[model samples]
Target: MTLLLSGVDSFTGIHPFLLVLAAAGLDRLVGDPRWCLHPVVVMGWWIRRLQQLSERWAGDRPWALRLAGGVITALLVGGSGGAGWLLEQWALGRGLSDLRPAGLLALWIALTSALAGRSLEQAVRSVLQALPDVAAARTALSWIVGRDTTELNQAEIVRAAAETASENAVDGLFAPLFWMLVGAGLWSVGYGGAPGPLALAWGFKAASTLDSMLGYRQGTLLWLGTAGARLDDLLVWLPCRLVALSLPLATGCGPGGCLQGLVAALRDGVPDPSPNAGVSQAAYAHAAGVQLGGLNRYGDQLKVKPLLAAGSPRPNPAAVERMLRLSLRLELLWLLAGLALGIAISAVGSVQ
Candidate 1:
């Protein structure tokens, strides 16, 4: 415990909670800068390059394509963690104490890029800004959601944007921090500057980027995307549930309401077919008392997903805005939880 905190202090030159607060602050204030070489952008380029190379090498065989895809997924996902691990090693070993401030600055920048809170808010807000103009809304929605926004009504657009903000809140914020804390705990147990947490976070980012780029039914990548899609689902499963269950507490909806929200989520979210996305989306819908899913066009095909708030008030722009605010609150809630855990760990150490 002391060892873990000490390792965190050694690595970042600050306490773990402070480190988390700093990272969160940076995420809120400075979203992915257009100027910086974002890690996700780097991963995206790598994925595209691998896709081109693999397609040529694997020929037309379905099995060969799938095999090549699995290899690419493994390499990128594992390599993301390995790269972060190597950076931590380099920073700790070769970087001089006189260079500590520079090292910390670099890490801060890297960690800031890991989160997508403000950027996501901006995305939803973009659609909201383009409102009443269906053409404009569709264009803005295209930037955030995978759905074909051609036939969507204003209410449908609002619901879709809210659902996206809810779902991404887990992927973009909660899960990464959970993994980082785990790695920090591991370091305290005699592991030297446990690189596992940051590695896992970035690795999740890599898998998510791959899934986004390749996981589509109507493409040459249908088979190739299977590994990325499945790996992303696997990585996010637990964190999805955690965020879903915590939504009530985070939003201060009270215990009975929380239980009601969870039950509604399980009842409705269970049938959405997605393992992880449903939980958060459903929880958000139930907690906010707004209907979410319905029939939607991905392209020429129509998907009739389960309606979340059946016979209830539909989400308007105000509700969608509130959902966005809830997403920000969720980040702060996790920070408080992290601080409490640190306090508990320190207390136990003192008793020992």
Candidate 2:
């Protein structure tokens, strides 16, 4: 089940847990630097190119379009994972000792590139900062959400912003973090020949990008995007649940609050079409004591989302701010938990 690398165990002087911490810190400090061609951008480019190619073959045949989509999904996911594997191999080479500074830096940058916590925060905050001027706020919100923002009132604007912040917290941060940790654990436990953190993270990113761009329920995308959308849903399912459960603890809420949040998330999120977004939004809505979900417009197709935290009040800028802060707190909580687990593993190894 695992691909054993050539001299896989030869790489030394690097720990993925440490890299995760370093990456999180660097991401918080610098956000995503746009000076370089970002990995997500590359993924987007590939999606566009591949989709065009698919169109040539698919034509007006629904069945053919669906088949082409599946092929494209396989190619993109495999390609992204392969890219990650190569990057790590190039960095680790025979060992970190040989590459030293360059190797470590490369590993750190690669891991950091997978996270978007800081960027998510900045984006949500931008909407808040542009508030009081409804139009400016709408413009800011438009940058982050797919919903039509033109006719939104102040409350709706705030609600949309909060919803996006919560949903993306799962998509942009926790999901990738979860995969990276899994990849790190596999590598650290001596599966070096297998896909490492970057491989898993980038693979997830590719799926996510596909869903965002092509996974629609209407028109041509209805059947063509099934594979990509389902793939993303599967990848996000566990992480979304984990985030929902741990969010209360991250906010320093006691057992009672945690239980309530989980219950709310399940009750509200289960009914939504998406396997993940509803749960994420519900958890944040409960945690922040704000209601979310209502009528939304995506390019003139009006859709109504199920209300989350129905008993709660509409979110304000302050509520949105609380959610952002909670996201930061949750990030730290998970990191600390990972640190503790790493130490326990080390202690057991020493005993053996």
Candidate 3:
């Protein structure tokens, strides 16, 4: 832990431009893979398995299920993080320079995999290409979104694809980076290198997994998933809103549109059930001059959400592409900012 912290602190003094260049290069080389067993995926599978087992034991006991789920969630999160930290420490002890071109290579790969930008772009592109055929489009959209796409029209398809892009910008990109920063800071404090970040990432993955598995409002899950859902919501609050605000800069929406979109989103998005999703969706709708929010079905359940950016232009396949482009830009901007901040802190500390 001490070595990891010292290494991170030492590496932080490197130039920002160099750090970003290295990270970006590594990201380009190690794009997201469909078959790769990502930590999040593994964690999710374990969580679901736990939930199922708990249900079997607890039966209809709502309180017992919830309590068990919470305890399990904590253990999974803590355990994964601890293991990741240990692995990171071992990797660093192998004498990897924290900021050398080669050192940056591994870090970059880690960051890129963490971001999931390429995977998201592929998902959006698949939806865009499928738009000419409604059935194909529905299938492709289903790959990325949780809703039923069968009933969607062209506009709705566009809206759904775009909304997913915007929302994922926070979840897939900024959220991980935020925790990475937190972990890096801890490393600087002498805890160790990437363990802090890895642990944080694992914790989030656990929370996200719980939300996905048991977070639904439906039967057998509402109580069990409530705590996990709320914790995930709380964890993502800042990143979601920050990404929402940054969308304008990322997508070329301009300050005026950004402000209007945020306000409009606030007015219209508040009615939606998710505490955090509306921030980005509303902002994107406002910025892109599109109206989003309407009836959505998850399985047999129908949810009528309040419209964000009401009366904006209807969306099309082109709109989906635009949203994808914007999200990519925003993610890149975030990456750059993180690199800059990390380098700045490292330099200042070194100077002192």
lDDT, each prediction: 0.76, 0.85, 0.69
Per-residue lDDT of model 1, residues 260-339, tens digit only = 66677788888887887877888888767788888878777888988876777988888888888777777788777776
Name the best candidate (by TM-score): 2
| Model 1 TM | 0.90
Model 1: runs farther than 4 Å from truth?
1-14, 92-99, 188-190, 255-257
lDDT of 1: 0.76
lDDT of 3 at 238: 77
lDDT of candidate 2? 0.85
List CA RMSD, all candidates.
Answer: 3.4, 2.2, 3.2
Model 3, C-alpha of 128: deviation from truth (Å): 1.3
Name the better of 2 and 3 by lDDT. 2
Estimate candidate 3's RMSD in Å.
3.2
In model 1, the worst 10-residue window by lDDT is 5-14
lDDT value, residue 263 of candidate 3:
63
TM per model? 0.90, 0.95, 0.86
- Any residue pairs clashing in model 3, and if so which? 1-191, 4-192, 4-193, 5-187, 5-192
Per-residue lDDT over 1-352 for candidate 3, one digit per residue giving the tens place of the 0 to 100 score = 4565554433333332343445444544565766766777777778878878888888888898788778777777777777656555544552335335544445445545555666777888888887689889888998889998889887788778888977786677667666665665566444445565655766776677678777887777877787888888988887777766677786666766656555665676667778778776887777677877888888888888788887887777676677777766776776677666666767677688
